[model samples]
Target chain A: MRMDLDKQLNGSVQKAFLLLEAFTLDKPEWGVSELARSLGANKSTIYRLLATLEKLGVLQQNRRSEKYRLGLKLFELGHRVSIHQAVVHCTHPVLEEVARAIAETVHLAILEGTHIRYLDKVESPQGLKISTEIGSLRPAHCTGLGKMLLACADSEQQQAVLDATPLFAQTANTIVSAAALRRELAEIRERSFALDREEYEIGLICVAVPIFNQQGDLVAGLSASGPANRFREEALPHYVSILKRGAEKIREGIGNFQL
Target chain B: MRMDLDKQLNGSVQKAFLLLEAFTLDKPEWGVSELARSLGANKSTIYRLLATLEKLGVLQQNRRSEKYRLGLKLFELGHRVSIHQAVVHCTHPVLEEVARAIAETVHLAILEGTHIRYLDKVESPQGLKISTEIGSLRPAHCTGLGKMLLACADSEQQQAVLDATPLFAQTANTIVSAAALRRELAEIRERSFALDREEYEIGLICVAVPIFNQQGDLVAGLSASGPANRFREEALPHYVSILKRGAEKIREGIGNFQL
Candidate 1:
């Protein structure tokens, strides 16, 4: 991928992105020398990149520590992205209602490359909560929302993603083989939904349904999640039904949304 | 500033930012040729930059039109930035309460360079609203929140910003003169609050108080905004008191916040 992109992408532009990618929540701020060491780049080049990012207001340097961190411009642009997605805006109230009705966390996710990108979530009103951040991504092989998207994806898309993805087991119940994943996806497609019984995380269970556009194309997944003990086998039917209804609502309203 | 930054900032890096800035809500997507023409750059340079951005997932190219738009990577980073800003997390509930109590929009903003960057907002339950994006920046000379921040800025910091700022009037009531702005700041410092009586926009009035950290250092501005007719001089005392109390709450809780 790097070689392919290098043929088209300017070296400097690529370096700028490399710099931006270095800042994460766990390691949000970085001194120039430390960052250069981590990225295996020259101090001068890293310094130049940091200065340019600062000038663009994409990165801000702490006055006291002189360590660089992500800036407010990205936050502003991100806010625009959330509203512009339209699907998020259209389905939020529906998600809230669904979460309340199910007494479980409700999540809206879109298929991004080979992963599920959580676009929005409504926390369970109950004491036991399953929470995840917006913009967080999870592998498409182990989660209910991931399976829901993969089930609806074209064969080529599925093959391309599965070929690159390592099916690392997240839990004892995780389907770690491509053949098994394919079989599960086929079942999901037939049922128009997917379920994960402690696959992505221990003591957690999730059920998801595909959200479609007016043209009947899969756009996203709507999921209900709760603790494994509370979300018993008997509750599956109800959870699936409610998730499908919520997904249907999103599909009906998201036809006009560009995202 | 550009000249100073140019000594360390790479030209390619600056051009990359220009590309990102081109995508606004009104014109979110752009063809390569159109963007090149708009940015006054050659086709190859613009194409390379677009390719780099697309590869980084910071921008996505539409498959049909081949127009490039901001992508989910930026949205992801932006989400992280919002949560990382401790000030936002600490003050959100207070802003919500303030909005409800005043029956007007409430805003929390931080001084960023010579501008005020809105960190959070709670909309009025009433039909009328003064809505703004979380990361949006506005000149510090006109807005009530901006003036509140500027009133407490150190002398050197104030002079540096005022020297560079043009103070272009947004409305007939805007104080465009440097001397007049200085006088207003002095009055705001004495009163421990600031007011914008349709200075930024016609028919809109805002009252703002400075939020201080436990150490008594000014950190942010909390403001209540409503239509000019509704937020008249007669209501000033009530608005100021509410805002001050809200600001005090934030100050007490925000000492531990790193932002």
Candidate 2:
């Protein structure tokens, strides 16, 4: 009986999370019937779980639509996350410093699957700056941060990720061929920096360097992004130097922390 | 059997959330045995739930400590939260504008029980700015944002909250007594703003105004904080005016959103 209860509990927990996962930026609201249909779940089961989640403030029901959305409780739990504390808070000031010096947007990101998840960012004071939201994920192949981190990734990881994700071209500059992408990664590894010249988005450019821990394992990527016009070739060396310095500071601050 | 399974699933979901809640900022990491003891539950049940959560990446086991902590999955879900998209993303720019214009740290907050949850913040550019973190909860009685939001709350809510929570003093100036706090809130309601003169922290001073949505319901509180020395008596009216202006902008942006 005890074993049965434990299995049931675990099952419920998994189901609840699966339900929460259905609510995304693309579709933030989910009515029980539609959600159950999408997940191939029983409608009554979905309804019961929704009620339980709502009771804990994990899911909130919209008054007008009668649909469930991810609630502020998750927002609260996110803040409690140690990764944000360990990585974001420790390296944010460095990102801010780099942003101020470069007068451009700065980002700290870690490789997550085939994407780079933005952990923290400091916006450029300029009227026009790259405005990617924090906690957002972007394609690794077409981003400076993604490439820098991916370059540092193990061979198995790189091959597996590349295999799983298509290198869709965002612009004329995006590396479309896998062989060419591998060559670019090799070059990035050799040089210890990656550049995105209108690769992800037109008129946007980025330069990134890997942030290593004291133990010499790559933990994150630090990057500065701005309008392609303002990112002069002459400033590439300068950008790399400042970003490397910021990376070192993060290395010191991060200590032996793991993401 | 369906009804039985539904009951078990709901039970498990609630238990899992309760277990998750045990991992807080103050005590982020937890061992299965310790957690079970704290929750006063069966060790086997807690162990199973922990394993399930760890499998889903909702919690991660620290390699050295062998304790579970909130993980990247929660951080990812936090971003997917609609409140963050509806409120923080919408008002963050305005908070930044106010911070830049006032040269003081700016915050947007909502009353949560006897506390105020910081939804978004823009730090002051100066070297000596307030250092409260986003998603942190602070005593509402002592903060400008808290007091302003609390002032606008319905009387029953105010009474229930005051009755439930002890008005603990943080500093000499903090409103320690419920009567004094009620009077202060009443005055804030009359003036349509709130002030904190070293009430929470010795050197910190703040001014805040309530932000109302399009339907004229108070949704949030917007505040600016600076050093007590810098916050002059003569500048009170100006601060109130700027805060009110900022609140008006939030009203324009936040249509009919509820926290």
Candidate 3:
């Protein structure tokens, strides 16, 4: 009976995934038929998949609205993935060293879709705390780590991402034009570092450098962020030097990792 | 051709989920055939499902091992689940209040399978530093919060958990017998608190009380812990009173939540 049922349900996997994909940042929760219509699948199929996903803790059904939202299990799995000992094993000690040397918040971030997702952060002991959560996503065009990653991407891939996204202004200092962003990326590549001068948020300045794998391909970026007052223009050279050295150490550590 | 392909692939959803279920903590990564054999599904069915899951980042294929492991996508979704928010929202103020009052580390934990998973913690202002990761899990029946949760379970459920596992002695004060454990649970129920006298680790003492929901069901536990030197028997009542008050606050907070 089980085998027959499995065979009968075999082709609905893509539709099930499509239904899940329909619940995103803007549409966090959805009713059954709304999900079915969004995914272009039948209501019965959507209901069955939603029920199964809920049972597996992938989706949670709200008792009041009969709407479904992403479940806690996804968060549990995301935490495990982001903190996979491989990522933390390589980054934690290096981030600590960077924090101690720079006296700033050191962050490690990797590309997730069109956004840069922070994987780890180490705060400076003396300064005012700059609290940033792991797994939080920031736009890839307006942040230091994002610019550092963009600097490493091939021109075609960079163009593709740019074409797909709106260069929305986040702050008075944000580089909103495609031409300006292109020039910044070129400068970042030439200097081997990227800077965010209140681009994402006013008063925050970030300096970042890319960490490459053994194959010399960019894997992630390491960044040091602080108030504009603290990370002043005169301090850029020193911050750049320290961030590059930290990135190099992390790259070396990544090279030694088996996974 | 695309429509034909979609139609052909439409029935494979459940088979894919079953393949994912094959991977667990003990068998975190698995080869294609091993997954197929374990799930009692065909190798072809498993491969197709795996390929789909891999594209969605639900299952990651390790390049070197040629085995599949749970992917980072799940972690990303899990991180967004707001469980940590629930923990932080429910416990942060209570933890701060208790930590300040007793000058000891206060923790909130929930039962996950056979383990007690620490969801939130606040460190004391002075004395030896007690370190614990937010998502770290430790064996139930060993820690104070674990014991508090276990004490609430029915005898058959308690026996089922205790009987199926290896009771590794964490310290000299650890309890291993069913009869002795039942007696401890009885006392804990009567007193409305639980204690760990260096049971999980030497030189550490912990006191815990249950936190219930509006329905009066145990939802989680709150605890205060410190070095054995500071948490003497004479100080037990003070610790117990503060812990119970913290738990009460959490229960009230949970009850008052509108969403």
**Per-candidate local distance difference test:** 0.82, 0.86, 0.75
Q: Write the per-residue lDDT of candidate 1 for residues B1-259, one digit (tens) a residue.
A: 1222365569887877767877877788889899888877788878878888898888888899998888888888887773334777558778878988899999988887778998888888899877576678888888999999989988876786678646788999998888898899999999999999889999999999998888888888899988987766787899999999998898888774545
Model 3: per-residue Cα lDDT over B191-213, one tens digit each: 88999989998988899999887
lDDT of 1 by residue, A144-178 (tens): 99999989988977896679645888999999878
Q: Which 10 residues in a row give candidate 2 chain A its minimum summed lDDT?
A: A1-10
Error of 3 at B73 (Å): 1.4
- Decreasing DockQ order of the candidates: 1, 2, 3
TM-score, cand. 2:
0.81
Lowest summed lDDT window (length 10), candidate 1 chain A: A1-10
Fnat by candidate, in order: 0.76, 0.80, 0.39
DockQ of each: 0.58, 0.54, 0.27
The DockQ value obtained for model 2 is 0.54
- Chain B TM-score of candidate number 2: 0.82
Error of 1 at B86 (Å): 2.7
lDDT for each residue of candidate 3 in A108-146, tens digit (9 for 90 to 100): 988765678887777766657666766567888889999
